[model samples]
Target: MEKLYEVFPCSETQKVLLATYTLKDEARRDQKVSEFQELKQGRMSVAEYEAKFTELARFAPHIVDTDYKKARKFEGGLDLEVFDRVGVQKLPTYVEVLDRSLMAEATLAAMKQGKAPATTTTEWRGKRSGFGFKKGRSFVSKKQNTRTSNSSSQSSGSIPVCSDCGKRHRGVCYRVSGACFRCGQPGHVVKDCPP
Candidate 1:
């Protein structure tokens, strides 16, 4: 009787352990799926966002089982400006969508810097230069000329030219090659500069 009681308790404990293990795995998977579904591009660059999306996507394969579905999911997570630009293309494959999103990001950045106009999607698709402008007459000539004048004035100590990038600025040069003004790190801007 004593041996029978010990055997039954040991088997019950093993069963409980197995059930707990299964439940833990299912719970973890569920969490990962939830995170994947809620992923967004907020504040992150396109490459960072894409890497995270790929990392979490494996947990929820059914959500992106088809190429179209995968592309759509990726598109939906882009920033509003990039999404609007890329969405208009109606790209067929995930790779195409990803490529267009990267281009859109570059174009938008150029626009923000006054280097490109807010052109139609058709114009954007027509031609592109290394600086994300439509190829033709140099649109940057005016800006370059202004910078040259400013630099010449800076030589007389009237204006300040950033020694780091040779552009005119009043205070710390925060916009030079996207380096942090505080620490001079290349990957982050001033506001996101780490202590």
Candidate 2:
């Protein structure tokens, strides 16, 4: 406030005209309009956004300026989803856009509370709750599966299975390439298995 007062330095004789009530009001209004242009909804509630809009609009009559620049500026401050839904191209007038945005906001609030909007055919209850993965489904590598099948047919009894990689105990397990535990060798495991 002191800085603003210092900015418009005028002699005491000229102060009466510059610091008049009307001039001060106009300056305040101009500041309000400037703030309105840079406004962003962010995490503000719909009511808070509307209140700010209304407060700023009262100060700036040009908020309904020609070519709808003011309207576009107002819409730009809204949430991206709301802006995309009821932008200048979509809505015919600023009034319509404002109305649609309010309605959309209400619908979104309803959805957050696990209630479907009036337009929704299916009931909304937040996100679907269930196990992350589907039941009766498991991964089986093709190479491992083929090798397991071959070993099952070749071996008379149960074939050895590694606890780590879950693959048949060949010369080298599928995952572990070197340092075979069986023979304690680098390149090979127990038997001279086929590549």
Question: What's the TM-score of every candidate structure?
Answer: 0.55, 0.45
Show where candidate 2 strays beyond 4 Å.
1-26, 120-195
Instruction: Write candidate 2's Cα lDDT for 74-137 as tens digits.
Output: 6778898777766745654455455567666765665576643442212111112211121243
| CA RMSD, predictions in order | 12.6, 24.4
Give the per-residue lDDT digits (tens) of candidate 1, residues 1-195: 346546666576777786688789999999999999999999998878999999999999999999999999999999998999989989888866776687677667756755533345443343333222335644444455455445445444533476887975443345644556665445777678787
**Candidate no. 2 TM-score:** 0.45
